[model samples]
Target: MAAADPPSPTGMGFFGMLSFRRSATAVASFDPAQEDELLALHALHAHVADRLEALSSHAQPQGPVLSLPFLSKLLDAVLSSSDAFRAVLALAPVAAAVSRPPADRLAADLLDRSIKMLDVLNAASLTLASLRGAHRAALTAASCLLAPALHRAHFARARRAIARIFPDDAKAGATAPSPSSRTMRALSVSVSKNWSAGRHMNAMAAHLAPPPQVPAAAAAGAGCGLGLALYTMSSVLVFAMWALVAAVPCQDRASAAISPPVAPPKQAQWAVPMSSLQDRIAEEWRRREKKGSSSGSAATAGLLAEMQAVERAARDLNSLLEEIAEEEEDEQAAVAIVSEERTREVTEQAEELAAACRALEDGLAPLERQVRAVFHRVVACRAEVVRCMEHVPRTASSNAAASASGVPPPQHHSF
Candidate 1:
């Protein structure tokens, strides 16, 4: 029975573990020097390009790029192979086009749809890149033509690939201060943190402070009144005249003597609450450790294990919270940009998107004129653009969907 064929790695089975590790291992098993997959992929691209050229020569609306349905597919196949090949052809015009949205609302919508189709192609490219593994220089080179600023994850992966060229930064004092040298550095950091907090508090106080115009006028009037009274009394030099003036009732204005209490800043309100929570948690942990230390070795071991678990949980919670904060900041930033970005810039971006979508849609125009409808949609998809922005928060979800569908996010302009 051949031991059931080792469970057939590529087959669909209930117990199949089709993970990145499995896929990577399978691809690594192949010898790139002997493999023809790279050659085949290139040929496929060449054939597609040839088809495109033929389509372009036609008097029909189809041009070199307007004809190849298999172009993206072939590019995917070539780039996916473990054998290294520079997919410069795929990187140039199509990637630029895929990133843009249409200018007009209707056109933007159409463009977005077309862009999405191309995203599937890119997704396939991502898979191929993943399988091939550690193509840093190639990917970095590709990213120049692809989404450069936005290719952080890719760049990071690329760095990891070429880490031998750039050794990991030193652990002790990489950024951390040496124990002996920590005094000045620690003081500086503490000072900076405290100053920031102080600045925030001061700003809040300023906002809460009452308008000074009223106080200024009141002080001036009071000074003038007192001066005049003193001058009059001095001129008279008569005790009887001063006594009569003092006995005379003046307009009651006691309220001016009292001051309104200033309101505390917004952050100030939450500072106590946050600090208290931290203090309580720290105290609980310290108490547990102390109790364990007082007990025998078994209790101490148990306490240490529990402490370790707690520490891990705390670390995980901190990580999760940090992620949440980052996501919130991203969302806020996107919102701020959407509202704050120049109308002209948005229009330009829309036009760029439209252009790219049109390019791809136009590519399909010859083989499938039916694709022209998609082109029209791409030209008109403003709502879709906004939706895409909203979906930024759900990147993992979108990425998962793209992977499941064997598609990738469209390689486009950073914005």
Candidate 2:
């Protein structure tokens, strides 16, 4: 061969050959499809790290840990990850089709669980309503005429009304605080009064459970990669939902048990960040739970910054009221002068609470919309999977489920 290729620099050289062997080994171990799927999974993991983990730093740098912008982007990441995961599943090997019995059951369970999140969404919306009520109470109190400008009697009455609305639920059967307006009255029913955040989230956790582990023998067969991918994606979904519930306010809120489901096979690239996210959230939750417990409140605090803002504003305003509302009148004049300093303090807190309310509500509107979108997306994905995996006719209950979830039956299965 003319002694020509004396250790050519390309593939024939020592280093080149070593690289080639490594490449060949990788190729032999994973077909291009599996390799691509793995890259996609890595991307998903990195996204969680990049988007979700980044929030921890921003929690202090920007403002509140769960600021409005943070929440908006958090939901965006959730939706984006869902879509990306579904894309991966859509492109899985055709051989994966026959072996999807495990995934089939998984998809069905996920679909059912997604519906249960509606109740969570409803509960969150109710919490938002309660926030609005608190905001209204702040406004009513702020408008009260203090010492000089208006009658002390008027200020006293306002204080009493708002106080009625502000009692912690630890006091049983507390009525909604009467507001100055009918709308205000309606807003005062704190979800914390009757709703149990712990119970609702526990129900959500029920749906977040991991699918049964596939037997090793079966997993070694044709669709092993797809099965792993499904389980991995399911773990991501479970953690995301549990995290969302943690961020919202709820009563008797116990952290959802997610260790089993959130933990993927060891050494997984995604597992690190997933576990990190879980740990941070759980830590924050424990902190909040401890704080609420120490404070003797019936409902536990939430992870949201705005939630804290709401509480602070309410507490400060109420403190001011205790000093002014319970005051023994001088009885020298009909007009009680509200010192400008006192008025300023009350106004500041009112505006602060109002601003916080707007931000929280603004954040919540998109969050709820995204939750609904998630619900429908899961429904559609499940429908597609059912069509692809099972040739059997659709049963009445399945059709009803599809109907109830608001995603029409798939007209045709193209994937």
Candidate 3:
């Protein structure tokens, strides 16, 4: 029978299948393009890590109201950096599989670091959401207080003007409009509706027209007094018009009710010539009316233009706030999803690494046993050789001693 062939070295176990030696050779082969790709990946990882660290340091929440603009910018940066790092991480398993042990170790380390960074990003996104909610609450509270405060301020200014225009007795006796008065309601409504309408000077002129049926002396005295009051109340009229325009539901009806056409009294009946005083009053009224119709119209038009401009600005502000809020929400959702996915991916990678380790250990166990068996056989063979040599040793030395002592030598026996 043919001698039995020795076992064929058991295919070198898992080490042979993994071919780590081949990986080492591949690592030694430096294709510039591959080197460049690896370098790029490393650089990208460093950049992303730096950005994450910076964001983690800076994104601490601090106030009752967050600056939406700032938060929006921060979220954008975090998302971009996290996305870049995630892309790099996605290649980690492939790198680990194909590269040498050192590269595999680096890939595993990178995955761990990336997972930590993602956790940081998730925390920041949640903080931003909380801040947004707080900001919205603050805005709502301010909105609740705004209109009423403005109404109160407008009425207070109107009251002061009315006091300065009228006599102390009349002012003391006058009952000011209540906050809930229809006139105030009308004023607010009209301001909202007719603020852009063109000036109606005739209506204003009629409204300011003087009362009829006074004695010449009384008229003169009144004219002089009226002139003084008008001087004091010139500035008051501008604000008063705002109030009147707001208070009067209908301009035609208010004007008709306030001023009725009165025929001038017979000039002959007057003992004193009050023409100068009358002229002064009429001149003042005419000047004031003309100013209201002409220059005041221009001013009103400019004011309306300004108001419209402010409205546009407010609209833009509102839209920007809404955009920031929406972006925060979207970023938060993205962060949550990414974080969960990354966790699962990391778990899978860890399991794979563990499996690979277990496989390596299993493969190493049989190889260790084979090496021990070979070592034991070599030791036994050495012991047998030593025993045979001991039995045959000292023959030459013994023969030399016997010749010196005249002793007989042993003869060889033939089989």
* Residues 1-415 of candidate 2: C-alpha lDDT, one tens digit per residue: 5533223223232212323333443555555555555455455555655665555544554333455566666667666766766665665343244235555555555555555454455555555445566655655655553223544565565565455545653135546644333332221233445565556556544544333433322333343334444555556556655666677654444545423336554345455556665666666666667777787754434577766766666566666756765553443334466666766665666566567656656666576566557656666665655555654333345667899999786432111
- lDDT per residue as tens, model 3, 210-317: 222333223212122212112111111212222222211222222322221221222211102222222322343344346657743321111111122222332333
Q: In model 2, which runs have C-alpha deviations exceeding 4 angstroms? A: 1-49, 61-64, 92-105, 143-154, 157-161, 164-174, 177-220, 250-261, 298-301, 329-334, 391-415
The reply for model 1, stretches above 4 Å from the true place, is 1-34, 60-415
Tell me how candidate 3 scores on lDDT.
0.30
Candidate 2 residue pairs in clash (backbone atoms < 3 Å)? 146-338, 147-336, 147-337, 147-338, 148-336, 148-337, 148-338
- Give each model a TM-score: 0.13, 0.68, 0.22
- What C-alpha lDDT do the candidate models reach, one value each? 0.27, 0.53, 0.30
Clashing pairs in 3: 187-246
Per model, state how many residue pairs clash.
28, 7, 1
Sorted by lDDT (best first), the order is 2, 3, 1
Best candidate, lDDT: 2
Which window of ten consecutive residues has the lowest lDDT sum in model 1?
249-258
Q: Is candidate 1 or candidate 3 better by lDDT?
A: 3
lDDT of 1: 0.27
RMSD of 2: 9.8
